[model samples]
Target: MKAARRALPLLAVLLAIGAGACANETHTVPAMPRPDEPVEGFDAHSPGEARIGATPADVMRMLAEDGKPSPTEHALTPEERRKLAAAFGALTPLHRRVLRERLHSISFLDGMPNNALTSPADANEPHRLFHITFRAGILRENLSEFLTQKERQCFDTAGSSRSVSIEAGTMDAIVYVLLHEATHVVDGGLRLTPGSAFTKSAWSDRTLIAPAFRDPLLARVKFRREGEVLPIDRAEAVYAALQRTPFVSLYASSNWSDDLAEAVAWYHLTERLGQPYRIVIRDQGNQVFAYEPMKSPVVRNRFDALSKFYEEPG
Candidate 1:
């Protein structure tokens, strides 16, 4: 091992559950390797990055695409139709064409015959689906509104070259939300359950459960593909989706995997600094501390015991 890396302080995390309030737990984390490979096999469907936050026209084209699901047509006010057409009209024929092709080809999607938000249908069936439909400005508005003072502070002080333009904020926020949910999908996909490989363990008030993770990811953070135009987690991909797309609301936040996904995205986005992500820890006393996954890192928090999932390559 390199001496520079050896100089870095290690994070302490518990691999398994122990007694107490679930808060006072401490464990050890082996060093995270620098990810030099792409997560090519990850469940992330690269329907081109355009699906991040699509517009109305993009949405329509997506509806008609090959693997695309037929969206429900709500009775619109004359104003609604106008909004829809304008939103739908915003896309170039090329962009629409691309979206259609991707959605059709994607298999991880969880919707029925006519639902929108077409995800890939791989082993990682989406655990959380967030379809946010609102006026052009609402989603961004809510994000700006939803973030607590601490959240905002964290974003502002983050290390990544990732930028959050208020103007581009809506898609930026939702894309993170999507990635967050996808993280949950990845987490669930790797488990060994009945209908699925991943099953949720019943949460006893005293315990927290973690995902039984799969490879590449089971390694350390890495890029999608070398020389890829953008990282797998990018804000541009989310905002580029046109306005015609349906609005999915907050239910995406309800899942544990979703939160992890968002946290990962946040870390990747602000990953410019050597210190990557800062995960909030929920201790036995039911207290929350924003712990950087670097020095002084404590593994177990409110979510579950995810330390065992960390693997050091042989």
Candidate 2:
């Protein structure tokens, strides 16, 4: 018993030192802008962000130009298309190929999407649209609003002006978030492509919207299986997946779909982005990760597994 007691202090010291190293890694990186506060000149709709919302004729028209988009897409208007066309090489051959395949392929009706803001296909037509977004995870919100200014100051005791930092750990997490979010778009059962996609002939003047899904904040996210009840073990696995995502927090585990999407996004970024990234953050002792876009061990294994799944397509 005396020997064990003597060793306990030494073990505690080692643990404390290890944790310190992990915490400092996050504080070492830079900060990013809030999600809603997008940069003015920075365009996210680059080749990587390409989405298909154009009609079949419109898509064919772009194909004639060697896969450049046509002039008449409602969301990506003619001028924007011209400006973004090859701007960042907006529609690379890869993007064009994927866009074309999705447009012509009816296989989408076989799959269902979670976290879709919209449904599939025009109730009036067979055509459909897909939306995509990118994120650099910084999980801090304006806590000052919710907490007293003194409490906020207490949270920021690390003496940083901006609330968060980019760190290696979070960058590892981003690999998951990017993939998960992109999946919500590709999942085919989103808005504009719902179950009625094949039933356009059955359309009536009265459009039906699920009452629960009316608000964006309260939207019902789709999951791997449509309407399947998630057990605690499965739900925990999903959260573990998302906890590995670059931007998730304790709050993310609140729901199953949110957890799944977060995990998927993190897994994708770490693997598919195929670029080196770093991470650095100072949690102000909050225990949150800070990541720079640096290469990471934690992200690599998770991403590799996810990539295999996508490539094999079960």
Candidate 3:
């Protein structure tokens, strides 16, 4: 879950187009299977599935470079591929390998909103495919428009504008979306626990989350509008509500899966990358509200839980 802050040039641009870290966890699920078992009814060619959709030559190139992506007709420009590659390079070796092996191929699409999605592949294999599509082009001008002015400002209140992309000021934004969706692939594809709370395909269902996470905040954390547009006026009240909960971002406040996804992604981005995760609000040239999750007692507790998932021996 990412947003923009006060109108600083790049940040302000982000503010104008911010849409509160858009993600829709909906997927086609056939039936319940063992966590490690192959999901039934996963159609690669079906409109609903997450196939590559790249040209045959492009698919061959991707397959030759790395035998991952299954097949589709979608085309990715060199720059888009570079961004994806850079994002892939940013992951820890462990995560990178897991994604490379478990993920079939990464697909970029046209006219899709600000979301990176994943779906299981066909056959008996447990692997999955990844898809990324922005509301506009991948460039800053296009990507920045994903959200509105007010939405990005609300997000910037907690995020450091300096930490986004130095060149385009959009890399952090792109990386966060990649990692957030990748976390889901790890959860459902690899069968990891703790963070692997949601067992079903429906992304919003918190009923089956692991006891450790469910017992604590699942019942209390309320996503203002679970599936609809959230008002800009509600930003203040909603962020204030986040202060008391273990969730790190407003998007995390959406659902259990969303909660873990945003937390895990930000944990790596801020804690590991040594980037800023500071949140502050000013009134009449004076600071009124401030919080840095890594430094805050309330947020750090949840951070500790997320840390153990990666640190403890598996």
lDDT of each: 0.26, 0.26, 0.43
Runs off by more than 4 Å, candidate 3: 1-24, 27-74, 123-172, 193-233, 280-288, 307-314
Q: Residue 51 in model 1: shift from native, Å?
A: 5.0
Collision count of model 3: 20
Tens-digit per-residue lDDT, 1-314, candidate 2: 01111222111110000010011000010122123433333334444434433333322221132334322323444544443333223222323433333322111010111111212222222233333321111112121121122112212223343232222232222223233433433333222222332112212211222332122221211211112223222322333343343223322222323333444443434444443332222234463343332133432333332332354223
Candidate 2, 295: how far from true, in Å?
8.1
Writing each residue's lDDT as its tens digit, candidate 1 over 1-314 gives: 01101111221211111001110112122222222332333333443322324323333343343555544333334643343334323332322332332222211122212111322222122222222222222123223332222122212223443432221122223333333333332333332122221123311111222322212221121111111122323322322221111111111121223323333444333332122333332223342333333222221121233322223335
Candidate 3: RMSD to truth: 11.8
Lowest-sum lDDT 10-residue window in model 1: 14-23
The C-alpha TM-scores of every prediction are 0.27, 0.31, 0.58
lDDT of 3 by residue, 1-314 (tens): 21111122211001011233443333222222243443354343332113334422322232221233333334656765566566666665545545554554455544333334444433234344333333224433322232232134333333322211111123335566666766665555444423333223223344343333333332332232333433333444545655665666655654555666667877787677765664544444455555555565655665545543355235
Tell me model 1's lDDT, rounded to 2 decimals: 0.26
